[model samples]
Target: MKTLLESMAHGCARCMYCDDSRGTDIDHFQPLKLAPLRAFTWDNHLLACSFCNSNLKRDQYPVDAAGDCLLVDPTVDDPADHLYLLLRCGEYDSYSKKGEHTIRVFGLNRPDLVRGRRDAFCLACSKPRDWHNLRQAGDAEAGRLAQALFDSPFVDVVHAMHRLDPRRAEFVVGTHTLPALEHWQSVYGG
Candidate 1:
């Protein structure tokens, strides 16, 4: 299994699936049953989440007329290039057929999930004092903020972002966690 740091750093950024929390199950981007030749290729391998790996995306490899996979592999390409996050509606808009399929398949705009993300973004923005003080505290202050987020119930949002968008999550967590990293035991895995 890929380490948390590795998953967060590479997997999340790449939007590749990684069932690190579960077992080390290597999945083909396109199912081996469907595309036997590409099955063993390194480009076809993706680390998947348990929900995506087992329940939803199991053996469901859709291909194009040329027999190429239709699914958007975040590792190879940027979903944002085709998909746009509708912050107001919490849905996704896409210009490509593959992007549309991916959003629908993954429920990228699930209402509750979208609302949760919006709320988290607002929360991070609302605390001006925390942010202002963070700059003055430097490393010591960053540790404190990290600790505060770790202990807070609101941290679930932070954790989810860590999995979904590591770069954004890391930025949020790093910026917010200033002055206190110890309090954020909820993240940083202690």
Candidate 2:
């Protein structure tokens, strides 16, 4: 078994295997059943969650012409750039083909994940002005944001929203999602 977790940490964005339970496995990115030629090729390997590798994806490698992927590669591209977490409905919407494909392929809007992302979004939006102030203060905003994100119960929401809707970025920080804001304010020091 290759050290797929290490490879993913270096390359895959938010590589799911980074939070492995039983260590990582060498997942064939394209699926060995679909692209047997690459069954053992290093380039075809990736570190994936058992959920992503087994129950959800399996050997299903859907692609478009030029053999490009229709799904998100947490390795090659940022999932946040294309996918968004819906605050009210907890569904995912996409602004681009890549995002659409990823959402469909990975079931990014699955009810459990949707709920989780919405909670994460709530945490992100609860303290919007602080983020703005941090930005104005020139205080390594990226690091602050990253820390705030993990600390927030709604951090997953921020990541999911960033993935689905970079174009209408305000949804993550808008007032329409006030329930999340209230929750954060009451519990998370917002």
* lDDT (Cα atoms) of all candidates against the true structure: 0.52, 0.58
Regions of candidate 2 where Cα sits further than 4 Å from its true position:
1-25, 127-156, 159-190
**Candidate number with greatest TM-score:** 2
**Residues 41-146, model 1: lDDT tens digits:** 7666665555666666778766679976567786677665666554334445786877777766655566655675566545544342363456456646755654
Backbone clash numbers for all candidates listed = 25, 12
What TM-score does candidate 2 reach?
A: 0.60
RMSD (Å) of each candidate, 1 decimal: 8.5, 7.1
Candidate number achieving the greatest lDDT relative to the actual structure:
2
Give residue 120's error in model 2 in angstroms.
0.8
Taking all chains together, each candidate's TM-score versus the true structure is: 0.57, 0.60
For residue 150, what is the lDDT in candidate 2? 55
| RMSD from true fold, candidate 2 | 7.1
